[model samples]
Target: MPDKDRSQRVSDAVHHRRWLILTILLFSLFVVVLDNSILNVALKTIAAPPPTGIGASQSELEWAINSYTLVFAGLLFTAGLVGDRVGRKGTLLCGMVVFGLGSLLSAFSGSPGQLIGFRTVMGLGGAFVMPATLAIIMNVFERAEQPKALGIWSGAVGLAIAVGPITGGLLLEHFWWGSVFLVNVPIVITAVIAMVLVVPDSRDPHPGRLDPLGVLLSMGGLVLLVYGIIKGGQLASFGSPLVWATMLGGLLVLGLFVRHELRVENPALDMRYFLDPRFSAAICAVGLAFFALMGVTFFMVFYLQSVLGHSPLQAGLLLLPLAAAQMFFSPRARLVVDRLGTRVVCGGGLFLVGLTFLGFLSLDTASDPWLLCLLFFCQGVAMAHVMPPATVCIMSNLPRSKAGSGAAVNNIFRQVGGAMGVAILGSLLSTSYRHGIEGHLRVVPRSQRDTAGESVTATLAVAQRLGPAGRALVQPAKDAFVHAMHVTAVGAGLAAFLGAAVVLAFLPGRGRGPCADDDRATPGSPPATGRDEPDL
Candidate 1:
């Protein structure tokens, strides 16, 4: 009776502090995810000359962005495994320190290469921090409260993504371009201190020996795949031998990695988890949702700035509706899932996202800003609905022991999807833009025509150089860009719709319990943990 009372008191203490712990975790998560998009608004400043900018070349600027993403995505799986083997709280703390130091170094970087190197360090830190947040949440929250905790966590991430540009724009307005990276330092420091006080150490109880071969295969495959994707986007063609070779090689290596893991005594990732329908369907849903969102946002920044004549600050403010809707609806999404189940909520959310993408097709230079804001709000609503439910589904399906690994794989899908979407959509945009304007530029000199056909920014620059004679090129260039935006929007919409279809077909219906369909197990399936059916 005395021991029972002691246990009850301990439980009460933990439960009392849960929300505080969650706040710290969410803040940590915010910084890591913010890094992914914060640099978007700063890239131009970083490439400009003067005390305010670093004068990086265009290619260097691209590398500055891609380097962080490539390293972050490639190292995520390994980070997750490491966190699971080590303690998640310790990993989170170390990650925060590294990330803060990296940001400080980035602010002091003399050249673009130095800044890029610092960003890579930041990415390495983020890989550790991201998975640890999810894993900690999975460990701390009770099953009944998991959805609510996850909802808040997901909302925080969505909010960070939405607000990242605004934060960058505001910083750049008053400070040097390096301030964007520097802003992370104070926030990370605060979170690191809070985490140490409130968060508990958690790790896999029976983490087996590391799989070096699996590690090599997975890391190499991801790095090569991302490199191929980025290279393909830059060249605007998958026809390049280097692109195909790298992508194919990455795929082959990943296949071998999976095979080796299945045969090994202690695999890095348990392949059996993929056999579960809920896990598989949820992964697909999250991947497609991010792919569309990332692709749209990538081009939308350019469109608002280059075509609509909005300042970076104005563009950032314009995106507020999207962010607002995401934050407002995400915490409520789990409720919708409770009533409708993952199948309906996830499928319907993606369907709505697709519709919103299609709505962009109707936009023109003269279109109302309010109208665009409404569309963005709708897109955000769809995203809010999709992500929380998908996240809950994925996390709930995995046993507590492998939550870190599961979270890593879930994020891997998102990162890969974002990378692919950006590459493919950017290629489509370039192709359509070039085809539209190349014919119109034939009357100009070959060099000037080639310059004008390169990009809308180039066309505008070339037009300025031509003075009044370039007036003929201005409207045509904008028109070509609008045309490309339409084509890309349609393609993005199609991908989302197809993903929704896959979710509907593969995901079990509403009446099925969480583990009800586990009877059709693989040869080496582990016993079910009897997780609740998400209050549906």
Candidate 2:
């Protein structure tokens, strides 16, 4: 056969195999995202002293979580650049190997410090895996089918969220806390095997010289910023000099990094991509949406476990409605977007998210479990609408060669926004709880009063030791947390409302579908545009 005929046949074969490749990609993504939430249920277990646990103190436990966040968020941009330079498939496979090794080491860690170090290694691998998955999808699928493909990809994240906690709970019930980390090994092996057999390799055909300075600056800035955010949330206060100074320093360094990118001959990421309204607005919307979602989730866990008297397993099970709604709606969100437009779909979804947050005001200790489930379902539906459409906007605006960079930007906003939410909203929750419980603390000794008022968990522990006398403190602690959660809900709701307003103002209305103007563009070239329709 002629060369042209042979090439056409190969293209058809690749197209046919795309869905199988997507399945493999989802498996890779699942393990990476699963580690993030799975560790939550294991924190209490890890805090116990002796062979059963790590004997990590509260501060040490906080560090164990923060270490992962700090590394993952810090390295995401550089990792994306690496994926674009090297082959995405190779980067993904290498990342999974590193991740599996880290998990294996973490499972057998002897000290809190060792666990923290191992978690950081896992974060490094995760940074590479996350962006490469999306980048590969962009390369594999045509523009016309990108939205549907991305929707399925987004749905997998929701599935991971539900599975993470439940899986952790089940493992802890039967085995050691390290089982949470150990579980990742088999999943990684399966994904790696599948990937090796089916996934195609792709990279930037015109990748320029390396930008070492850009890498250093971005890593330093993100590390300092995320560390400060984690510290503020842990302390439940940003008033400390350590928090303010570190965050400010991060901002300053990031400003310098941006300026350098603008002037550099071969930038790691093109600074000009932010000039596109669709790209900028969509990323901002993602950030704001995550801010509200993460903040609400942070408090909701405490409400379920501490206030509602649910076991970790029961709490995980109760969250099923939320995940179920996401899995049901995320893949279908594009169909809604096709009718109503990206702007309307995403903005309305955010508005609904705000309403659900406000709905928390109706709940108390006596509220029915069914009511809670209903609220969670509603919130999940809302988020399903926002994430998929907004992601489509961000990715569609970029050329295929820049998909890794675009994915990195999307994740950066998510990480930073979630950090801010947990810090600022958490501070509000802590302050309000302390104020509400201060009056009741007089009954306890002065030394224990401060510790008791620190958190509902501390108060419950204190109350349990005092037996009948301590029983008096239980009702007050629960009431205070419920009230504090109400206050935090209002703050989170406002963030969602702000996100809705942003998309409505800046995102385009009904017009051409995403990537319509650029569907015919060849690799390594800028996207072509001539359509009179709206940008997104």
Candidate 3:
């Protein structure tokens, strides 16, 4: 056969397999997102008192959420590099196995500490799986199909978020809290089998050497940075020597890591990606969007369960509109971006997010639940617009050779943003709640006052245990929680609006300059070049 005919045959084979591979990848991605959002509903069951609950504290509840994202974010850069060096498909399979094992162990964890530890293990697996999916998508699809492909991929995320809570709610209604973790096992097994059989193996031809020092610095820096931020918020004092020292040391180390990466031959992440205006803007939009989304979610689930006194299933049902709106809008985001340009679409999305958050400020204990649902629906639509376009913008800016790194970069910001959002906004709520209840708390017995002031969950428990004596504590605590949520919503709205302003100022408009096309893999491909940004 002629060389041309053979090449055509290989191309045809790859094209035939692409959509099948995408199906497997989407399923894998859905499971990861499912596990993430499902935890929100389960946290209440895990922490509440009784045979059904473990009686964990507020801090423990926060850790149960944050630990996974923290470790996942820290390890992502290293995982992406490994995937590029090895095969992406093999890396994904390894990740799925580990994730399944972690989930199995998590199902049996006897204490909060054990659960958190196993969650970190799942995060390690997630680091491998997350980057490989997007990297594979970039490799398999042509540029013309990328925006549509990404929309579908983003839609899977919306679907997972929609499905996770309902699934968790149903399990908690019928089974134990451990059932949530156990559910991932079968799904992961199916994903692994399908992926191995259908997905094509791809890796960088010149992956170069691993950057051990860069990896160490980045991981350590992110962990310390997030740790310090969480502590600063919880401890309620930036003046604390430990807080300042940890935060400053983390910042200094991150600075050094950037300097080192610039000097090294094989940087884990190419720093040059930031020089693209679209790349930087896309990353920031994703980060800011998640920052607001996670902060609100961290609080909303608790509000529904603890404040509104709804059952787990009811709360999950209430959140359904969010998923519905996201699924409804995300697939159509590409059309909006094409018509209005990324700047208008993304900026408009953030503005909508801000508007809905502002709307949340009006929510009181007496406000209708459907009003909250309406706000959630709007926010979901806003997120759909922001995420897909931002994803496209970031992937479009990168060379295909750097797809693994690019995907890692994109996810890292979103994860870090989520972790930070929880830490910061949660702290604000805690602070305000304490302050609001302080005068009222003084009327209670000193012993009961401290316990009641700890959290809404604790206050409710104390109220139940003490009967009428603790009854007075309930109204005050509920009032404080509502007030705190209002303040936090206002702050979140401001942040979303700020993100929109930044994107409008910096992100390039459509057809304004030279854009780099996605790099198609060919043997001995040359390094890609683009118009560099002006120096800082």
Candidate 4:
């Protein structure tokens, strides 16, 4: 056969397989997003199996969700590097196998500790898969086609993020606690089969030598830093020695990793990317965007269930609007970004998020459901603009050789931001709600004092039990929740303001001289205005 014919055959194979591979990758991505929130609804069920575990504390339960993402963040950079050296197909298949085993383990775990252990294993799988997906997508699609392909991918995950809470709620209502973990099995099995058959193998032709020291540095540093961030609230009042040591130690390790990367022949994650303004700006935006975005989502779940007296399923169903609206708009996001550019579109998104947060602040018990849906819908619209385009900017700005590493770094920042979001927003709400509840109860008349300790449902039960007196006290509980919601929304609004400020200041403005409408990924080319941003 002629050389051209062999090349043509290879190209044909990739072209046919791309869509099928995309379907499988999207399913894998969905597992990560779904599991992130699915267990949230099952917490009550998981804790209900026995006497001692029947009423787990909030922190004990939160760890179930936090542990997965935390471990995933720590392993991401190292996993991506390993995948690039090994064939992406082999790496992805291995990840799928490992992840499937974890799901099975989690489904059968007898205790929270055992479940967390399984989830940590699942996070290792996620680290393997996440960067592999992005790099594989970039490789499979031609440069011109990558933005649209990535837009679809981003939209899929965004949809999952919005829908996961609701889906978990629906499943938990109808099924057993283990059903949440069991659900991933069929989807992942299908994904594994499809991926093995359809996804083409790809690897870096000049892959760097493995750097074990770099891996240790990154993993150790990330573990310490993220754990510190997650535990910061508990340590805030006390300022414990471990807290200081871990945080400072993590910083030192990260610094050492950077220095090693700069000096080594083949570093695990090349630290040079920090020099690129476009990449740097894109990464910073990833962190800040999730800082506000996930904070709002984390609170909304609680607000609906705890504050508004909605059941877990009902709360999940209500958030269906957010996912639904984002899906409705996601396919068109890249077009909007192409016409408007990342800066304008992303800035506009932040502004809209700020507006929607204010809408949340104004919500009261008697407020119409449609009004709340509208606010979430607005948030969805903002997300469609921010997520896909921002990701395209980050990936496209990188050298082709470092695509996997770039994706890993971007992913790490997002997860870190999410962890921070939960810690900060959760602490504020817990503190504010407790204070508000206490104050509201104090003002309650002696007549209705006894009924105040009752659950929201219990209070409703006694509304008829205590007649008009019990009914009057019901208003106080509602008032307290609404006031706490006000504080949460204000915090989200301020977070959005801060995030948007960073975008406006650092991200290149629209209508510039050379980079004005540029989306090219030309290698070794000079940046616009003759300024050099460091290479990744």
Best by TM-score: 2
Q: Which one is best on lDDT?
A: 2
lDDT of 1 by residue, 1-536 (tens): 14444332224555577788899999999998887677888877887776768888656877787787898899889988888888788888998899899899998899988988998998888888889999888766666677788888888888888898888888888888888888999999899888877887777767778898999899999999998998898788999999999999989889999999989999999887787777888899888888888888888887887789887788888888888998899988878877877788889989999999999998887678998899999998998888887887787676666678778998999888998888888889888999998877855678677657767876876777788877888888888999999999998999899879977877655766542232223335443342211111
**lDDT of candidates 1 onward, in order:** 0.82, 0.84, 0.80, 0.71
Instruction: Write candidate 2's Cα lDDT for 1-536 as tens digits.
Output: 24444332225555678899899999989998888778877887897887889799767887887788888899998888888888788889999999999999999999999999999999889889999999888777766577888888888887787668888889999999999999999999999999888888777766789889998898899889988898898888898999999999999889889999888988887877777777788998999988998888878877888899887787788778888888889989999998889889999999999999999999997778999999999998998999988988888777666678778888889888887887788888999999999999877888898889888877887898888889999999999999999999999999999999999988877885552245434323455222111101
- Which ten-residue region of model 3 has the weakest summed lDDT? 527-536
Q: How do the residues 216-303 of candidate 4 rate in per-residue lDDT, one tens digit apiece?
A: 9999999888777767643322156776677788889999989887788877865665666666766777777787778777767656
In candidate 3, what are the lDDT values of residues 1-536, reduced to their tens digit?
A: 24444332234555567788788999878888889889889987898665677777767876776678778888887787777778788888998899889899988888889988999899889889999999888777666667778888887887787678889999998999999999999999999998877787766667678899998898888877877777766664557788778878878888989999889988887787777777888899988888888888878877888888888788888888888888888879988877778888888999999999889888877668889789888888998898888898888777666778778888888888877777788778888888887887655677777777766777777778877877887888888899999998987888899889878877666665313443422223354332111111
lDDT of candidate 1 at residue 307, scale 0 to 100: 85
Candidate 2's TM-score:
0.94
What is the alpha-carbon lDDT for the whole of candidate 2? 0.84
Q: Give the range of the ten consecutive residues with the poorest summed lDDT in model 2.
A: 527-536
Model 3, global lDDT:
0.80
* Residue 332 error, candidate 4, Å: 1.6
The clash count for each model shown is 0, 0, 0, 2
Candidate 4 lDDT score at position 402 = 60
Q: Is candidate 3 or candidate 4 better by lDDT?
A: 3
Regions more than 4 Å wrong, model 3: 1-10, 236-239, 513-536
Give the CA lDDT, 0 to 100, for residue 301 in model 4.
Answer: 68
